[model samples]
Target chain A: MQQTNRLRPFFENITFDRDDNELVLNFGPQHPSAHGQLRLMLHLQQEQVVKAHPDIGYLHRGIEKMAENMIYNEFMPTTDRTDYIAASSNNYGFALAVERLIDVKVPRRAKVIRMMLLEINRLISHLFWLATTALDIGAMTVFLYAFREREYLLDLIEDYCGARLTHSAIRIGGVPLDIPDSFLIDLKRFLDNMPQNLKDYEDLIDQNRIWKMRMENVGIIPTQMALSWGCTGPMLRASGVQWDIRKEEPYELYDEVEFDVPYSDKCDNYARYKIYMAEMRESTKILYQTIDMYKECVEKNETALMAHAPQYISAPKLDLMTQNYSLMQHFVLVTQGMRPPVGEVYAATESPKGELGYYINSQGDAYPYRLKMRAPSFWHTGVLTDLLPGSYIPDVVSIIGTTNIVFGEVDR
Target chain B: MRRYSPKDNVQKKPYYTDRYYVAPQVPKLDVESDEEFASDLAAIESKFTVSESYIQLDQLVVYIDIADNLGVLELLRDERAYTQLSELSAIDWLAKDGKFEIFYQLLSMSRRKRIRIKAYIDEAQPVKSVQSLWRSADWSEREMYDMFGIKLINHPFPKRILMPDDWEGFPLRKSYPLQGDEAASWYEVDKIFGKEHRETIGAELRDCAKVDRYDTERFSRLGFEVPKGADISGGEKRKKVQYQEDGGVFLIDRFDEEKTVIIRDKDR
Candidate 1:
């Protein structure tokens, strides 16, 4: 059997009666508006796109291959590089997978803290997406406003963890450090100001004629099409499918916190953008609940961070230095790593983008036998070729931005 | 809290029953029931070789034969309403019978349940492509091919996704080395700097000059003889040679320099 290129029609099948002025456009493995290292080959007839093929993998770093070589705990840091904008969500997803594999139950206080960090990370990611997407659509002022708030969130993250970008704050069983004393104050301040910041963004682009013309009715994907294409997060929500891993599966204390899942039946770029903005507000609500829970736990004199599993989770640095048994456990954990039972488990969490899942197969080894990351961006990127066809050539950038794809996860 | 023994049945029943009664509960929906799943699995038992199926980590996991991949996936998608193919990944089981395990994670939006389907295939065998069933399988299957070398039959464009088009050997294979093989040079680096510059850099960084005379095997392997003038105790002025290669200047230190170290400016 012979296989022809799917993007191009066969020469024998081409009829000369119609105009055959199809121009093949390679839209950026390096183009500025491509968002990241995405190379889309579009077959255009005049201004409309006849066919679109996304050639990804330029940003691939073999993170999965690297996971097989490193110990389970060592691989947590590498997950940060996958979706760097939402690094904590990646870390939390990997940590949850490892904890589930080893059956290490996290403490109540630790669970609350983990939930708080993940929601904060979600806010950071959504802000970053809003900033870049706004900039892509010619709303430069929104970029400035969103980043102004983003810096405050980054400062809060930096106060908790040492790093700003790839904050490997999450440990296997729980979080490494407790929230700082001033962290809540700073978070409250940011949350109080976030609504105003969101309003500032809305003022710039929400009613602008150009923004509406560029977004509405363009790149519209139906609910069925979106689900079949495996689109998650705001992309799926924009298509009127209220499928969120947090609401459906309820991982990491999400059940305790109350927040609404925003959805829109418009199923266009504007609907997706609106869904993202609404989601930020919902995340803020969840954040407020998480903070209150944390304060309550502190008042009750409960352990606020780190699970008490001695074998599965490493002891704290102070405990490792003082206690002899803790020292031995820490030494062994650091050197050889935890050995999970011979089984496989898939754990997914609702990251800012969508369902970020980790599938780990451990053959009773210190390192994962096979670790697979179900990056939501990967599936989102796959739908581009489907969505881009029949749309205008200029609308490609709008579609890409609205889809909110980060190549880190797409090409991981 | 007092621990109640099973022998004290009266107290145990009251305590346990009260605890359950007091807890808040949401009314259960008839959708995604275990009975429905059991009946569905029973319906497809003849077509698919249902080796094992159980709940793990609160998600349904089913292991099916490799040949029935298409039939089972289609049944799940068309009949059972598992519309969303959440993830499709491959696992290398080289140690156990040298087979590759492929996982299909399906999520039913209406049912609000996730089911993971697993199938094992030999290293060289090609699994049936589910691109027609779920569009998400296109890239996932391509990635599986790129990483684990498990081919997807009838895939539209089956090529190396993460690795380069001509890259040799799958990187995620259990047999593949972590640092990669020496035979396959970093072609991207060579593309940036010309082949001649790459060879020059490689040769300058080789450990031939760093070996001691006592390590005769390493010295001979590099085709270098022990020079009588290898002594470098003198405080001689170090010669700094700079070669402009590919828009960046590489500085070479020549005083007791075992291997060449290149330092470039931050802006370069």
Candidate 2:
């Protein structure tokens, strides 16, 4: 067949202009792959997206506003709603910020227990990411397999705290309840089983051509771009920046634990996925070490789980029941909550999602004066406007999944 | 119901204080106390004017001119190597000082130090957008506008990020009632059905707990269900809820409890 440019001038005059050919597709606020009320307004020039604007705040419950009215202790449970996937991380982040504000030192046993909960939460959240990302990328078997393991992890958290999703396991100053006797046994069992499950997941999709094709080179956030765009956690790590808050800022027993931060410089979705996989392994290593540390504390007969700052922390239940003075103090502490010093502190913790920071300003009042949740998902969501352009429409799902953004955090 | 009070001026009254309450303050150290912070401040002050700088909680806090946000942030990023803009937002100081204190938290992974650039702007004053310096500031500045109604100077697409485009008032303002204002009560009614239907919809409850379950108008009780305006003084009869239509779904089989199979064993 022979093709000629004889009618090129005639065709050029009548052909559709770039503006005329451009189409706008509204991806979500309803779609499952949108990952919880993330409405993406994608402007497409044919199959390639010209621009993407993430429309957020479908889940904004005015948590910051609510935090203002509630007492310091009351706000801990509300923090769980920020990143519901790993609720304990949100709990600990707020608790750590308040602890810093009040200058309270946690008992060693509680510190060890908090570290274990954080790592378990990291594992649970990462497994959830694995399940959902695979499900979104059209691999169903891994979703089922990943969730099967996720249930066991959630059960471990359930043993620690009563609730699974909104586990407010952490408290201001110290933990409320001591770690259960069965918890360590269950954690030891789960830590042993997690490695093989992680291996099984890699075997399922690591080398699969379609999975690689979807994730290998998609959503490449360069190292400089990531920093400028406020990327953290795996997003920052995958971009080759070796910055982890756990290592840089040692809160609780993170300084005592031995674990490596997993990072790769591929700067793509696959690198982020591999980082998440390696991080779960690292979390297992941390859990094993922390459990041993916890046992040593138990052997030393350090039974005090809550910090003994009577002015700040509530007295132990046994003391409250027996002693009238302790009961009176408990009543006062509960009625008019502990007043932190009038100062603003920006405390960042490496949440399962990213650097989940709480910028709490106190007015020497029971309630927080102004509270801002620096959610990792919010920046990751904002970066989409820059990342989504010049990519195919289908890649949007893979990118969103890899970022691991939950709207609970984004629209908080 | 509790006695009605004026909601508008609630937050205007200063926070309660007493003779017994001595406001404790966090110790703020001089910037020169930390050698690393001293150098960082020296570099920042060389090019731009710094109104005040101090170290609080190991973070260097600098109060800069609101206009010089972009220049200072650019210098920090390009020159000082403080790559990440970790947090950016405004605090409501309107009750105390009638000004909003805007803070920008910049982090340097290489140096392992944090510096905060803060500026105070009068209420409703427009602040310069740092979206050019840090891309993350795009949504953040929009959020500041959406929440506090703080206008931006030169932001590209300065629309509301959280609230709807037609939202009436700034929700995060200290004066704004936490329970909601009059405009909030009528927001959804006006949004979904237009302002003309405001009378038809009445007013939305500010508190969900106040809604009566047995009102025979809106709510439908689980066991004691009845029609919209049913007179139930004698008490409505208890009934089992029907899951499907009377004729059943066309292709779907009706469930018979006698023959229903339950997977009791785990992982069946």
Query: Which prediction has the highest TM-score against the true structure?
Result: 2
Off by over 4 Å in 2: A1-19, B1-18, B211-268
lDDT of 1 by residue, A200-285 (tens): 88888999998998899999999978988888888899999887889888887888889999999999999998999999999999
**Candidate 2 lDDT, tens digit per residue, A153-217?**
88888887878899999988778888877988888888888888899999999999999998999
Q: What is the lDDT of residue A226 in candidate 1?
A: 91
Q: Per-prediction RMSD in angstroms?
A: 12.9, 7.5
Candidate lDDT (C-alpha), each: 0.81, 0.88
TM for every model, in the order presented, reads: 0.83, 0.90
Please give, for residues B139-206, the per-residue lDDT of candidate 1 as tens digits: 88888888878877899989877778888877787766665655345555566676668755442322
lDDT of 1 at A190: 88
DockQ score for model 1: 0.24
Itemize residue pairs with steric clashes in candidate 1: none
- Measured with C-alpha atoms, the lDDT of residue A183 in candidate 2 is 88
What DockQ class does candidate 2 belong to? acceptable
Per-model DockQ? 0.24, 0.41
